[model samples]
Target: MAPDLPVRAHARRNREKLIATARAAFATADGTVSLEGIARQAGVGIGTLYRHFPTREALVEAVYGAELDDVTSSASALLDELPPAVALRAWMDRYAAFVSTKRGMLDTLRAGWASGRIATPTTRERITGAIATILTAGAREGSLRADVPPGDVTAMLVGVLLSAGTDGTSEQTGRLLDLVLDALMVRRGPGT
Candidate 1:
């Protein structure tokens, strides 16, 4: 058992390295990136890559799932460090990064999802839940509006991100995000 432990640990490390390398490649790759290239970049052999992910679709699915998990889980962590409204804005930036990463795998993801080769994740639901958590906290703190539905916020965010496009500059994206945040913030009228 002791001997097996080290081997397993090494394998796990290799697997994680592959996933991380693939995520970075997919984030910037213009089109389909080669699996062999990914394996080389991860400092592993093609066989190791195959051992961890049997197919290209499998790798894409894993990367997508990992990105989804990161973005969804960041909301509460941001809230802990910042006010609710600020947390929401930070979460949006994270969400935008998630969207950008997804672009490289979009073709494979769509096909795999359409053919049911990959299990469809509850992506929209999970994202909406994260938004709801921050929005609820903001509402309680009087930093954000209380009347907006979380789903609406989700829809608007999608629109903003999609409009930004892959070619959109960071400044453009930031401005768009600010507009969305402005809509969610509570308005203070004349002096109390």
Candidate 2:
């Protein structure tokens, strides 16, 4: 959104800064950082942060939305530069990163939802769309299975990430992802 004037420009800039700093804190903190702290770290007053985000969930939505931007933007890049299967794999890797961040902010995110603070779609749908885009490309190239729905793949990945987050086991995530990928790959039934 292009601002027609300088005051709107400053508001845009302030909101961007708030989102950026809140994201860093969400990713790095022990999921305990509050809105006041986020505002302070962003070098803005609490009032300004509240004026912009209005609530914790609003700030969280901003952060989660930025992550959607990252995943979808990377998908475009991978599609432009790499083969379908390779691009899909790289996007899966980004999924892991996204899951990691999501887990870190789990508590705050949940709290926001519980309080009805953020009104936008959660990261789930956006992430699913991003995965579906890659999977559709892979299917067109005869790499991934065409029958499975993208929403199913998205649900599977989210379930895997959640389980991996709970178990705190790195090996499980890779193994589970391989199983998911198996379903998407060209079928080779029963020992080739």
Which candidate has the highest TM-score of all? 1
* Pairs with steric clashes in candidate 2: none
Question: What TM-score against the true fold does each predicted structure earn?
Answer: 0.97, 0.80
In lDDT terms, how accurate is model 1? 0.95
lDDT of 2 by residue, 39-149 (tens): 888888999999998767677788888887888779878999997777877787788877787766777677777776765464667777777788888888888888888
Candidate 2 runs further than 4 Å off: 1-4, 120-123, 187-192
**lDDT for every model?**
0.95, 0.80
Model 2 sits at a Cα RMSD from the real structure of: 3.5
The clash numbers for all candidates, in the given order, read 0, 0
Looking at candidate 2, the ten consecutive residues that score lowest on lDDT are 115-124
TM-score (C-alpha) between model 1 and the true structure: 0.97
